[model samples]
Target: MRKNKLQRQASTIDKKFLLLSLFLTVVGLVALADASAPLAQRNFGDKFFFLKQQIVWAGVGIVLLFIASKIHYRLWEKIATIIFFLSLFGMLMVFIPGIGTKLLGARRWLVLGPITIQPSEFLKLTLAIYLAKVSSKNKKLAAYFVPLILALSLIMLQPDLGTAIVVSTIGMAQLFVSGISLIYFASTLALGGVLGFILIITSEYRRDRLLTFFEQTRDPLDKSYHIRQILLALGSGGLFGVGLGQSRQKYLFLPETATDSIFAIIAEEIGFLGASILIIIIVIFVIRGFAIARASPDTFSRVLSCGIMSWIGAQTLLNIGSMVAIVPLTGIPLPFFSYGGSSLIALLIGCGILLNISKYGKE
Candidate 1:
């Protein structure tokens, strides 16, 4: 009887959710192929260099997504603490002299021979799982706040303010869904806001980013150059766009064209209308994710699903919001659209787990 029940659940995974994830991933590859051509050619003498690597990562991500989907969602609950610590340890490994790779002044990647990964990316998912597990068991405030603060401190030490923000957001979202007291939630938010402000004012680059956000005309050729170019690309694509593969900005005009700023390239080539369609699809995907959370069979799965959706939604908002000048520039990549293997793989695995949880959700 139990075997039959398990088989039924496995056969009933959320198809809409799975299909949307795959669709966004495919669209991301198409956009990356166009956006990275010039940069790849100039840097590596091969126009397809970045695209080829991303395609390989995508293939791996898809396989993991399926494997994760097959695994029992409750498995994470049992090993949550172990994996969380392991991921936290991975973040620490990034600070080890020869093992850590420092790029653009940030020590955020672990380099083992030819393989490079940003451990902070995996930390986001692991932290979520751990928090959900503990919270579901009715743990105390110290249980949640300690791990949350420890993880955030390490990520900030890497000086990755963008990822720290995302991780903190994920932690807070899970805490909120787990039914923490309103007073504590409010206090946590206030504390986070105060700490964020202090961190920004104390850091030269962060202070400059904040200042440039408020005063776009301050340093057109220096601090604000990236945002200026982004705005130019956005304006160039009035309504229908200049058409795909024809973005002027992608031709060395935009910084981080294939990674953090890929969305701008998509907007430049596909226009406002096409960008709207992409945004709509993302919105639908997130909505379905929440629907799965709503139908989740238990508190752990429900909270975990919520955390995953919030992670995707918050990251997307930060990336696109920066592109449109709605918020200060955060060097976070768009989910599924970014060109990094670590991020893509981590996200797919999260989605896969979510799909597994959906199988046990109320029909």
Candidate 2:
């Protein structure tokens, strides 16, 4: 007899993964409805244009989650290497002219006819699966990590420092959970940090970002403009906010209001309490994710759960930190709340994988 495999599946199918996604998706839609109103009204002549797009994408993501949730998480282990390589190829494809699209000087998107996809977004999940598979094969390799660092360099070549950092951090966290040699981990960490710093400081734009972080007021009209305005939005919110749909900042006063700075609009609308609650929900998600991972039966599922959780949690923290002047800016969005169809889809799929893992996780 399979002993209680069937019972476990029956019991765990709709556990924390479903619950967290439900909370996040609902909250994300609500926030997007609020944040996208001003930007949509100004750009699209409709208050709900962006929100509608998000709702459609969320629907598609839900379909994906529903489909993926029924599949076995172990299948990811089987295809992880192939997916990783294919995604790496996709990342490299951005260098090919005519095929790649550049919006603000940096090329990071692939345009195929009428459709475009950001490879870095897919690369995050690919790397997560690859790390989980590799760690399962040999835990020692987790410590002497370079594959992710190399991929980060490739992504940074696209000049997308934000995605690279998120991908790299998730990879590191996966390795950390694998319990590889600490000395090797430290060596990889120091080397990777030096390389990352070198890469950042060497670039004129990135260096300007760093310098702005140190003295934002020095270049108020230049590099620091984004930071200054973001801080102004945060400060203007004070304790209670400026009231719903009344943000003066979104009226062409803030850059990337629909993307990197979406959280600012939230702060400007509902104040500090709202932001704190959002953070609390994210923390709850992380806690539940790790608990499921820890409760998993197999090494692959364990690492996979950790990888997915870290991917969302670390990115969320970095996004919020950069928003409020706690860290250097990375133009990453706040997961589902940001106006990106691809990001939302990828995240929901990742969440689905977590659910699959939880269902079959070891006791």
Candidate 3:
């Protein structure tokens, strides 16, 4: 009877984590409605265009979250290798002539019938699963390192430096948690940094971004325009904010107002105080996620939980960091808040998996 009761207790889903996920999703929708209004009106003749699409995706994502929570967490471990390969294949699909959609000199999305998706976004989650599985079974760094390099190579081919960074961070985080040698981890970190610097210098546009970051005052109207606008919005929000739904930057003045730079809009509307509160909530969510990982009953669940939280934490930092000009703009969307179907759906599914693992955690 004691064993049975303990098992039952361990099987209960993490309600706090689930509610926090839903709250972020709902808050994202609210921010999107306010941030994308002008852009939607200008492009589609409907103010709620992006919000409507996001609402549908949010609904789909929430349903997946619950379904994923109910499924056994070990199921992913059984098929991690297969799904990781599928994710790689999906990345390759973006290079196909008829299916791939190229915009602004980057081939990052695929259009299938009426639906479009960014394979790299899903690649992040799949890679994390595969890494977790490999780490749990093998202690050797190369066991997971080879696949990490392969996935990073494929993503870099898409020329998405931002996502490549996030993916690499995810892999490295997993490697660390898997108890790899500190010397090997440090060596890899140094190598990655050197390679990243080389990549930046070799690409003209990327180099320009680096230079722009250093010389923000050089060209206010040209290369620095985007960052300038972002800073302006932040400045406008001063303390309390300009009031929600009244952001002037949303009127086509800020680039990626609803996507990569939505945080600025949020800061502009709610001010520093409101933005800080949101940040605090996100921090709490991450802390709770790690707590679940710490309590996991097996190595697989523990590593998997850590991977998911790392992905969220790394991406959130990148997005908000760039918005405030603390880091160079990387074109990565803020989780939940950014307006993209692939990102939102994949994230929610990952959260669901985390919730499932939480249920199996030791009391």
Candidate 4:
């Protein structure tokens, strides 16, 4: 009877998490419909093309999440190391000339026959699983000093500095949950800050982005075009916005209107009020996620919850921050609001894992 009661309580808690995930999924599709309509209509002669694709991806993601939620979360522990190594290989494979396809200037995607996928997206999920599993055992190191440095090293190699930083933070959080010394944690933060500074200085493009952020008006037509446009969109959004699907910027006025800077586009069309509502929804989702994490029965699931929460929450912040020029352009999509099939699937799978964690949570 006690076991049954515990299981029922867990199921109830999990339902809340599921509803939150579903909320984000549905809202993302609706936003995508607005964000992708102009470009889809212009290119495909159909306004719903991208929206249809988003809906399909969302469906696939939900299914993937369901499967993940049903399975025992411990299975991830058994294969965590293997999964980490596989993702490492995938990250390395992105640099292999023909096998690795470089779009723009970054060689970040791999082509596997009909599928062209971003390994970093998968990296976010797998790294979380691996870190959670590994740290769940070694209480001292996991809670102490290893996670921030070790995990950050692997992520930085991808040259995905933003993700590397976020992943490092996630690992550190897991360590903290495991009971780390706060003084050492501060030192780790300082070290990461210095390393990030060094990486930014050594990388010319990143340096330019930092400079452009400060002097956007100085080079309005040059390196600062995207920054300037994103700023205009946000500024133009006013309080009530210009109205949905009526964004003047989407008429080729903003670059990556459907991808990286979609939030700015959303702000422009829907105004501050609409953006506030969206932010509230995301905040509620994050709170629910943390609730599930805290309510979890064991250490691994707690760490798992932390990892998953960090991945989605961090990515959302990076995407929106980059769009608004509060930070450098990370080129990351706005969660479900952006247009990437692989990204959507990976994210969904991660959420599913979280749902599973909630279902098996402790009393």
Write the residue-wise lDDT of candidate 4 on 183-297 in tens digits: 8777866876887799988998889888887788867887899988998998999999999777888777788877887898899988989998988888778888888789777
Each model's lDDT:
0.93, 0.83, 0.92, 0.79
**CA shift of 223, model 1, Å:** 0.4
Count clashing residue pairs in model 1: 0
lDDT-based ranking:
1, 3, 2, 4
Task: For candidate 4, give the lDDT of residue 25.
Answer: 80
Off-target runs (Cα >4 Å) in candidate 3 are none
Runs off by more than 4 Å, candidate 1: 1-7
Residues 35-55, model 3: lDDT tens digits: 999999999999999999999
Q: Report the C-alpha lDDT of model 2 over 1-363, residue by residue, as the tens digit.
A: 476776756456646658778778888888778777777998899989888888888999998987778788888889988988898998899889999888887898899896688888888998898888888886566332667766787887888988877887888788888876799778878887898899888898888888888887977876899999999999998888899878888877888888889899889887888778878888888888888889877778888888888989888998899999989888898887888888999899988888777776655
Per-residue lDDT for 17-63 in model 1, tens only? 99999999999999999999999999999999999999999999999
Best by lDDT: 1
Counting clashing residue pairs in each candidate, in order, gives 0, 3, 0, 1
User: What lDDT does model 1 reach?
Assistant: 0.93
Count clashing residue pairs in model 3: 0
Give the true-structure RMSD of model 1: 1.4
Q: Give lDDT for model 4.
A: 0.79
